[model samples]
Target: MSKLLKDYLAKSLQDKKDRGLYNEIQILDGANGPMIQIEGQELVNLSSNNYLGLATDDRLIKASQTAADQYGVGAGAVRTINGTQRIHQELEEAIAKFKGTEAAIAFQSGFNCNMGAISAVMDKNDAILSDELNHASIIDGCRLSGAKIIRIKHSDMADLRAKAKEASESGLYNKIMYITDGVFSMDGDVAKLPEIVEIAKEFDLITYVDDAHGSGVMGQGAGTVKHFGLAKEIDFQIGTLSKAIGVVGGYVAGSKDLIDWLKVAARPFLFSTSLTPSDAAAAKEAITIMTQSTELNEKLWQNAAYLKEKLAALGFNTGHSETPITPVIVGDENLTQKFTKRLYEEGVYAKSIVFPTVPLGTGRLRNMPTAAHTQAMLDQAVDAYEKVGRELGII
Candidate 1:
């Protein structure tokens, strides 16, 4: 390696450490469920995105194993080649059905789905209006498209409408696309899709929603777009198979023409290897299970409400979240990290979000309560929160 490159890497890492922005990853000894073991210490985990706790579901595991037995492991090629197996097509069909769309196309991961989908449809001649707090993947995807990017205020409908009107009237671009997260991962705020759809209709703009954190947790497991009854109105409904679906992959569900265009124009689908046989089969089974029953989704909301009530009653700012994601706000970044460490020591494993991920002064401990978590686990978590919070003078 070059000495200059090595020095630059060292300085950048040190700068991150000084700013308390460096993340120290934790290792889980087993599956990411309600409870997890890290460094031989079992803790009530609240940091994972496994909202419905489907990651370790026996049915999903069995489906994956069965697929492995039948088709081996990997898909062996990209979707345009021999990689497009029966399971892949079936999963895509399942996604379309679940999302209430005309068709769907799958990718290896949600990030790639965003990277491929946005670039596939919009280009330098286009303009994308994105939410200020949208996920990194969406931002990167927009950049990749070489479009003129306009950032709208987070959940501010007025700002969106004004921007939409201004951009449309300017007529500087061939097309304008409005994109947002169905559920903002950091604050757990649901996007105003109904209003967004209305604005899109009024301005004749293309609509896209990245429902990565919304699938299996909203709209009776359909997603946030369906939560507001705008499934058919939105042009693109993007989601992930890795989160509540409990597998690995991402997809875009939309009209038949949109999906056909994605299949041919999306570079990831055309170039990257498709999801492995087990992952695809497991994802399909998971979606089927969700469509068949809302038991898991209900439990997820129940746990979320319970935890939020407990934390807020204890005087912690739970933030303005409408979904199962609970954020315990701590203003100082260093203190937030310390609070997380203290909670871990007391047997709860919730991580702190700081700058670049969220606004600098709004550092928080984000808790993700899942369907598999029990009352006892929640009570124990509350106890740990109280103890650590009181000790740190945060509550």
Candidate 2:
């Protein structure tokens, strides 16, 4: 490397270290489940987004293996080329049927689905009203769209209304689109889509809901839009096959015309190779299971309620989470990190969310309760939390 390049990186890394902002990645030695092994320690894991515990489900694994054996591995080309297979078509149809849309299109990831879809629909002539706490992917997608973005307060319907009215009356743009997450991952709060849809109708605004975290966890495994019973009204319903689906990829479900347009206009689907056959097969199986039964979803909510109630009873402030995600709020960053470290040492693997990821003083330990976790596992985790809170004087 050039001396200047090396020197620059060194200085930046050193700065992060000095400010305790550097993140160190851990190596998972096995499959990600309720319990995981990292560096010879077995811990009760509460840090995964696998809400339904389908990642290691035997049915998904068998489906993936069957597909791999028949189709080999990679797609070998982009979706526009020879890459789009029968399985891809099946998955798209499944997603549309599941999401209650006319059609659907898949992308390489949830991130790029946002990147490609937002840019394809809204351009420099358009304005996007985005929630302030939408995911980073949405922010990047909005930036790429070249549209004038107006930030609405997080889940504040009144602010959304005021902004929508202002943007519409100003006549500064030809098209107005409102984009937000169905569930905010950090705080685990569900979006107010009913109010959003109402406002959209009044202003003729196009609505987009990125339900990445809500895909298999809400609406009997459909999503948040369906949960609110507004599937027909929302314009773009985006989701991930990775999170709750326990595979890998993203998709946008919408009208046939919109999906047709995206297939041609979205750059990622045109340029990037499609998902490997195994991943696609696994995702298809996951959706099949999700649609067929509510057992997993029911169990997930039960576990979430149990953990949330236990933590609250123990005096940890789990800020307004309406979903399975539980954040144990610890205001100080250093204290939060130390608390996580103690939890890890005591056999629970919850991680700390400090400055920048969250507002500086609102550091937290984000806990994800999956359906695979038994009551015993949860009790053990609570015990660890109790012990650590007392030791740290946090409770």
Candidate 3:
């Protein structure tokens, strides 16, 4: 590396260490579940996004194994070449049915789906009005699209309307789209999809909702778009199988024509190999479980409510969260990191998210209470919180 690059990196590392901003990574030695083994120590885990505990489900495992035995591992070529298996088409159909859409297209990852889908639809002449606090993938997607990105204040319908009007009146673009996350991952706040749909109708703009954290958590596990009863209205409904589905891949659910267009135009879909047969089968099984029974979802909400109530009663600021994703707000970045470290030492594995992930000073220890967490496990976690809170003077 050049001296200048070396010097810059060294300075950055030093600054982070001096300010206690650098967080140490922990090795998870076992399966990631409500309880996990880290460095030979078992801990109550509150850092996973496996909302329904389907990641370790026996049915999913069987499905994956069955598919692997039949099709073997890996897709030999990209979709346009020959990688699209029968399982791929079946999975896409399953996703469409689950999301209540006419058709769907899958990608290698949620990030790639965003990157490919956005650029395939919009261009430099078009403009995009995006939620200020949308996920990084959305921001990157907007950039890749070459659209004139206009930021709207988070959850502010009025700001969105104003920007939509401005962009519409300019007449410099052929179309405009309003995009937002169905559930804000950081704050756990649900998007105002109804209001957004209304605004889109008024402005004749395409509507996009990235339901990465919303799928299998809302609308009886259908997702936030269906939660708001706007299934057919929204143009783009994006989701990730890595989270709720307990598998890996991302998908965009929309009209038949849109899916057809994306299948041909989206670079990732055209160039990258399709999802492994095992992953596709596992995801299909997950969707089946979610649709057939609400047992896991019910357990997840019960646990979420229990934890939120206890945290509130204990005097920690659990921000404006309406979902299972909870944030124990400890403002200072240094304190947040220290707090997470202490929690780990106390046999609870929750990670601290600081600046860049969230705004500076909004540093928080984000907790995700999954359905797999037993009452006994939660009790132990609560006790740990109390002990750590007192020691750190946070409560």
TM-score for each prediction?
A: 0.99, 0.98, 0.98
Per-residue alpha-carbon lDDT of model 2 for 42-99, expressed as tens digits? 9999999889999999999999999999888998999998999888999999999999
Clashes of each: 0, 0, 0
Q: What are the candidates' C-alpha RMSDs?
A: 0.8, 1.0, 1.0
lDDT of 1 by residue, 1-395 (tens): 99999999999999988878887999889989999999899999999888888899999999999999988898899888799889889999999999999999999999999999999999999999999999999999999999999999988999999999999999799999999999999999998888888899999999999999999999989999888888879999999999999888899999999999999999999998889999999999999999999999999999999999999999999989999999999988889999999999999999999999999889999999999999999999999999999999997
Q: What is the lDDT of residue 256 in candidate 1?
A: 98
State which candidate, 1 or 3, has the greater lDDT: 1
What lDDT tens digits, residue by residue, belong to model 3 across residues 298-363?
A: 899999999999988999999999999999999998899889989999999989998788998898
**Displacement of the residue 188 alpha carbon in candidate 3, Å:** 0.6
Q: How displaced is residue 237 in candidate 3, in Å?
A: 0.3
Off by over 4 Å in 3: none
The weakest ten consecutive residues by lDDT in model 2 span 15-24
Would you list the C-alpha lDDT of every candidate in the order shown?
0.94, 0.93, 0.92
The residue-level lDDT of candidate 2 at 191 comes to 92
